[model samples]
Target: MARPEPEGRVRRFSTAERMVHRATGYLMLLCLASAACLYFGPLAQLVGRRHLMVTVHEWSGISLPLPSLLGLFSPAFRADLRRLNRFAVYDRQWLRAVRRRRKSPEARPAGKFNAGQKLYAGWIAGAVLVMMFTGLLMWFMGLLPFISRTSAIFVHDVLAWATTFVVLGHMRKALEDPEARLGMRTGYVNRSWAQRYHSRWLREEHVGDLSERRTVE
Candidate 1:
């Protein structure tokens, strides 16, 4: 027998949230691509292209943090962040389950942002801040002492490598989870999808209302 399709309005991300996410995504790609070329390959030797790429990379890096700041002004994003960033006792258990996924797939319950996702968010935030400060020092090299410039460059390179690895992992996870991609693409997930992956967020967002019940079933 065919089951009835779930009924309820699927909560969508706000336009502000989507916009900021998209902007940051584009800028991060730009920065990473340019940085990659500059860091390795003969591509950097193409006349003035290296310098131009560096300029674009630097500006894009500078723009990366704007989205999160703008997103903070959004009540929804702010609220989501509050929930997503809270470290839970269960998160370690979730992490353990993920590590043992081959043995017990059903043991791990998906979440709005899993333990891995939360860790990524915090890492990226810290990395960007460090990169911004170091980039600034590099940009205004002569204003600071030689020691500062040298140290900043060292830190900048280190953090850039760290970000590169983190972004690669993020991309890999997104590829592995098609529903996660769809959620971002459509700005909505099916009720089952939400219940399976983001139940806590769904509950928190729609507590004590007819909407919450509708969303669960």
Candidate 2:
């Protein structure tokens, strides 16, 4: 179990997990930017570097799963993976309680990752796989039928837009919860933050660490 750094905080992300997150962030941004440059004529002309943009997007897409696969080498990373895979009774309740925020009793015993977070993780994992498959098909256009290549490009473009929307929504929610960011960055979150946002997780994982958070000061 990862613990706080002596400030009464609780460890939320391991160093390995943070590294994977940072790598994913950078790679996703690179993929998005380079794809924009390659797909948009105006942007391609603005940058005047279509040659390099294609290479950047291709390699970035190819590397999207590297960080996650590499992070499996860490025990903490593997443990977090298991936790994300496990959806308890509280998880379903947490999903229903989203609109109610903390007003619902179901929100009281949420584990480390709420239902939303689990869904997001699952979603992005599937999205990445889709992107990678379509990207490979598009890249090796000559190896496949012309219609196949066309289909891949169409799916890839649509998923690009979908992923953009999902990421933006995630960013908006993260902005509303700065302590969640702190947990990722510092590997710890104030105990009170855990209590409010993830009471059951704190209580179940840490001994004497469940400090209920009512409001932020």
Candidate 3:
């Protein structure tokens, strides 16, 4: 028996979660901007200071995982990570509905993290690790004689472009859902929005509430 949500609002993300997301997003933006300046001749000349841009790009990429790694210390973030990692029966249904281009929210009802979001998170996590590995290889080419510098650079470049497009798509989708975006930005979502799109999560929250109350009693 959870208490009623106040002002039709319910907690969506913890402060730790929001902080990690913002830090990671800022670092990713920095990495991408610097990468563009390093890779594009026109932009490189426009920005000048090739040496400085290279240093920025390399360090930003290297630091990309720090926020997430630190966030793991927070129980709330770790719980969300578990949610993002696992897919349920509803996730499969959601995917099928998506493939059929179902436009209604009911057709794509999800828990805390949807099927598409889970996939994106998984893909981006893998991409970050791969990018970091290739970046290090490129940065210390002489030290890593086993790995080819040219190959590392090529893979890193292609992945950077792919990641950029995927991030753009993610942002576009976020923009379309103002309430969802607000949840990430402020850590609270309208209760009705959660009921409509994340009914399963709402139910789970209630169950946890009941369990906590029972233990206290």
The candidate scoring highest on TM-score is: 3
TM-score of 2: 0.87
Off by over 4 Å in 1: 1-9, 46-48, 102-106, 142-147, 206-208, 211-217
Candidate 1 lDDT trough over 10 residues, lowest sum = 1-10
Quote the RMSD, in angstroms, for model 2. Answer: 5.9
Rank the models by TM-score, top first.
Answer: 3, 2, 1
> Could you say which candidate leads in lDDT?
3
Worst 10 residues of 2 by lDDT: 208-217
Every candidate's CA RMSD: 5.1, 5.9, 2.0
Q: Taking the tens digit of each residue's C-alpha lDDT, what string does model 3 give over 1-217?
A: 5345568798989889999999999999999999999889999999999999989998999999999999999999999999998989989999999999996878997999989999999988999999999999987768778789999989988999999999999999999999998999888999989998999999998899899889999
lDDT of 1 at 90: 58
Backbone clashes for every candidate come to 0, 0, 0
In Å, residue 206's CA in model 2 sits off its true spot by: 2.1
By lDDT, the candidates rank as 3, 2, 1
Residue 64 of model 1: what lDDT?
A: 96
Please give, for residues 1-217, the per-residue lDDT of candidate 2 as tens digits: 3332767777788889999999998999999999889778898999977888889999999999999999999998998888888989888777667656766544556788887888888889999999998888877776657557778889989999999889888889889989998888988889887888788877777544343322221
Higher-lDDT candidate among 1 and 2?
A: 2
